[model samples]
Target: MKRSKTSKSWMNEHVSDIFVRQAQSDGYRSRAAYKLIEANEKFKLLEKGMVVVDLGAAPGSWCQVINNAIGSQGKIFALDLLEMHPIKNVDFIQGDFRDELVLHELENKLNDLKVDLVISDMAPNISGIKTKDQAGIIHLNELALDFAINWMKPNGNFLVKSFIGEQYESFIEAARVVFTRVTTFKPKSSRDRSAEIFIVGQKIKNIEQLNDFGLE
Candidate 1:
């Protein structure tokens, strides 16, 4: 079957993206790696010996970035509904993050250690429905926030991909109550026409305080 014009255009753009070319040269799995790298550069999130979680980690790009940034001393637990090729120094959990069993497995991996950082690059399969896509992004962001509240250290940081529509402002406001600092970041690797932005929440004080913030 012939590809639609839109699909062909998207393919062309994806093939020619500078980040994509750079990823190939740098031995990264995907261009998405640069997004995390750029965000970390801005927020100073990743560090040596820190425990981190990568939610919705597929194709292992973000996992690769985290592993490289944190080095061998740090540990990374990555989860995704889709199968991801294994990356060195990352514990890969293949399952839906929303499932209780998967969540339990993640907690088990922690083994009493609080996470230093939680990064989520989850996005729903685009359906060409803007409102639905936006809602899906918001829902994933909420889930990532919940994980941060439950599993993160007092000063842990969270970086999540969110769409800038509908719940965007309210979500940032809600994040502020749990985190001492909250900011939205759009990396240069992110396409200019894309609505996606990274929300960085830092210094989570107490999980109980999240209830007051209404993100629980």
Candidate 2:
């Protein structure tokens, strides 16, 4: 198949990217690992003995980060629509995480254990339409947030990858309603031209506060 000029240009750029080179040298699956690593350093999001759920985990770079950071004491469940190669001490689930059947399977795997952290780097397939793409991205973030609300333990953290778009402010406000602290960050590892940002929501708020905020 002939590659389009745009794709060829992107390929050339991707091959020459510094983070891509670093990822190759560091044995990480993707450049995205550094984003998680940097966020953890600043936020102290991961801890020994913690239970984490990683959404959109393939090709498993973030799962690799979680695996190394958590050591033998922590548990990680990595979910994605595509199959991922196995990682030491990490559980992989292949399915659409938003589906009821998949969610049930995830819950069963956890065996009622509450999650200490919910990390999502999930993004919808880009369709090249601005509004449509934005909507897709926001919907994924909403699904991730909803999962965090239902499953995260108190004082747990929710770290999600998002973009500055139509739903950005409202999404952050929704996070503020459920979490005691919410902040947006962009890692230096991310491409300067990219709009991606990480929204960190710390310490789940009580139900009363959620209701007060009209989030319940």
Candidate 3:
């Protein structure tokens, strides 16, 4: 089958992308690793012996970044709906993150280990319909937030990708209420045309203060 113009253009751009070339030479799985690298540089979030949860971690680029930053002492729990090749120390879970059973299995794998950081690069599969895409991404962001609230260690941080849209303010407000500080970042690695931004919520408040945003 002939590739659509969009797909062909994406392929061309991917080939020409500096970050893509850098990722290839650096032995990372994808260019997405640079986003996490830039975010961590600014926030100083990853530590040598922390436990982390990576939602939508397919291709395992972010997991690679986490693995390098945290070293062998740290633990990574990575979840994705699609299959991912194993990363040396990452515990990969294949399932829909929203499903009750998947959540149970992930928690079981964690064995009640408190997560020191939760990062999500999840975005809905784009259908090119703006409203629907926005809604879907927001829902994923909420799920990421809920997971952080439930599983985070005291003073843990949550970093998630979010798009600028009608839901943006409400989402930031919601995060502010639960975290001691909430800030937004647009990594240089993210395309200039893309509206995607990272929302970093640091120093979480008590879980008792959380409003029902869907938690187990």
Candidate 4:
């Protein structure tokens, strides 16, 4: 089958990307690993013995970062819609994490331990329609935020992939309502042309302070 021009261009660019070459040399699964590495450096988000959750964790690059950063005593629970080859010290659940059943499976794996950090590199399937794609991206962002609020320990951190578009500011504001501190970042490894950004929410607010963080 012939590849489209767009795909060919993407492939060529991907091949030439510095992060991709670096990841290959560093034995990381994908270039995405650098994004997390950069974020952790800036935020000090990881530490030994932390319980971390990685959503949309397939291809396992971010999990690789978590596994290395958190070390032996730390726990990593990863989930995705696609199958991921196993990584040491990482427990992977393959399913649509948005579904209640899949969420239950993840919860069961955690065994009641509140997560120290929740990182989602999730993105919805692109429909190529601007509004629809943005909506789907925002929906996943909201779901990831909700999951972190429900599952993370107080002072826990939430880092998620988000796209800049309609409702983007409101989404950031919603994060502010639930978390004591919220900030956004564009990792150096992130493509300049991409609208995607990472939102970091530190320390879930006290229960009394959180109202509707669901873009209400």
lDDT (Cα, tens digit) per residue for candidate 1, span 131-209: 9998888988988888888888879999999998898888898788889999988999999998889899989967567
RMSD of 3: 2.3
Q: Write the per-residue lDDT of candidate 4 for residues 56-158, one digit (tens) a residue.
A: 9999999999988889999999999999999999999999977999989998888889999999999988888989989988888888888887888878999
Displacement of the residue 177 alpha carbon in candidate 1, Å: 0.6
Better of 1 and 3 by lDDT: 3
- Of 1 and 2, the candidate ahead on lDDT is 2
lDDT of 2 by residue, 51-146 (tens): 999999999999888888888999998899998999998898999976889988888999889999999998877787878888887888998888
For each candidate, give its TM-score against the true structure. 0.92, 0.93, 0.93, 0.94
Each model's lDDT comes to: 0.88, 0.90, 0.91, 0.91
Q: Which ten residues in a row have the lowest lDDT in candidate 2?
A: 207-216
The residue-level lDDT of candidate 3 at 83 comes to 99
Candidate order by TM-score, decreasing, is 4, 2, 3, 1
